[model samples]
Structures are given as structure tokens and as C-alpha cells.
Target: MKEPRPDEWRAAFAREFQEQSAARFEKIGKQLQFKLARITAEPLPAELHELFKKKEKALD
Candidate 1:
């Protein structure tokens, strides 16, 4: 059996990193969407709602 070259190992590592990062970002986006929707649906004081809105925007 042949061993992987350094460049091959580096390419594989980079590919894995990119896939993990994409998955992580996708999960985060879903979570943020759910949280924002829940916040919008629930009733709250004006100030707190605005605070959440700002946070949501900041995450974007």
C-alpha cells in the first residue's frame, strides 16, 4: 500500500475543515432562525424585543 503524500494529506485536511465549517454554519443559521422566530411570536416588552432584534441582526 502507498502512503499519502504531504500535499495529499494537506488537501484532505483542508477539505475536511471546509465541510465541518459549512455544517457548523448551517447549524448555527437554523438555530438563529428558530430563536428569532420564537422571539417574534412571543409577546414581550418593547425594549426587550428590540434588543433581540438587534442581536439577530448582529448575528447576520
Candidate 2:
């Protein structure tokens, strides 16, 4: 078989990276949704809730 050109190899690498990144982000998003649901469902103390809000804002 012929060797893959540099550009073709790069393109393949980029496509694979994109696919993996997308899959990882999708999984993370689903997990975040589940965690958010659980957190929202359970009532939190005012102090703890305020801490969470601050932490989230910091991340943003």
C-alpha cells in the first residue's frame, strides 16, 4: 500500500480528535445534567447553595 501523504495523515488525526472530543464532551454533558438534576431536587442550606453559586460563577 502507498504511504499516506502528510496532509492526509493530518486530516485523519484532526477528524479522530474531533470525534473523540465530541464524544467526551457529550458524556460530560450528560453527567452534568444528572448531577444538576440531583442537586436541584435535594434542598440545600442557604449557606451551601450560596457557595455553589459562587463556585459556578467563578468557573464561568
Candidate 3:
């Protein structure tokens, strides 16, 4: 088989990089969700709950 052209190689590399980046981001997001769910399931300090509410309100 013939070697891939320069453009073809570049395109392949870019596609692979994007796929890997997306997978990594997805994994991180899932981990963050799991941690947040765990934290929310337990009783939190009143100060922390207030802080979280403020932060969430600011985001809205």
C-alpha cells in the first residue's frame, strides 16, 4: 500500500486528537457529576449550602 499524503495524515491526526479530547472531557464530566451527586446526597454545612446557593444564583 502507498503511504498517506501529507494532508491525509494531518486530517487523520486531527480527527484522532479531537476524538481523544472529547472522550477525556466526557470522562471528566461524568466524574464531576458523580462527585457532586455524592456530596449532595449527604448533609452539608449551612455555610457551604449558602455559598453554593449564592454561586448558583450568580450563574443564573
Candidate 4:
């Protein structure tokens, strides 16, 4: 078999970068889930709720 060219060797690094990115996102999701679960809900103030709605609408 022929040896891989430099680009072929570099392709493994690209796949590793993507795998690392996916791991980071999964970790963040788990952490956010844990944090949000611990929040006890009190009545959200109306102004804050309105601001949250506006932010949601802007994202949409």
C-alpha cells in the first residue's frame, strides 16, 4: 500500500477537531440542564417576562 500524502494525514486532525466540538456542546447541554433543574420558580416579574418574550421574538 502507498503511504498517505500530508493532506490525508491532516484529515485525521480535522475529524478530531469536530469530535472535540461535539463533546463540548454535549457537556454544556448537560451543565445547563443541571443548572436549570435546580432553579426554583417564583413568579417572574411582568417586565422581565416581557423582555424575555421580546428576546425570543427577535431570535425567531
Best by TM-score: 2
Q: For residue 24, give model 2's deviation from the true position in Å.
A: 0.5
> Which window of ten consecutive residues has the lowest lDDT sum in model 1?
40-49
Local distance difference test values of all predictions, in order? 0.98, 0.98, 0.98, 0.91
Query: Residue 23's C-alpha lDDT in candidate 3?
Result: 100
Q: Estimate the lDDT of model 2.
A: 0.98
Better of 1 and 3 by TM-score: 1
Worst 10 residues of 2 by lDDT: 36-45
- TM for every model, in the order presented, reads 0.70, 0.70, 0.67, 0.56
Residue 55 in model 2: lDDT? 100
Model 4, span 1-60: residue lDDT tens: 999999988998899999999999999999998888767445688999999999999999
Residue-level lDDT of model 3, residues 28-58, one tens digit each, is: 9999999999998999899998999999999
- Candidate 2 local Cα displacement, residue 42, angstroms: 0.5
* Candidate 3 displacement at residue 27 in angstroms: 0.5
Residue pairs in clash, model 4: none
- Stretches of candidate 1 above 4 Å error? 46-60
- The parts of candidate 2 lying over 4 Å away from their true place are 46-60
Model 3: pairs clashing at backbone N, Cα or C within 3 Å: none
Winner by TM-score between candidate 4 and candidate 3 = 3
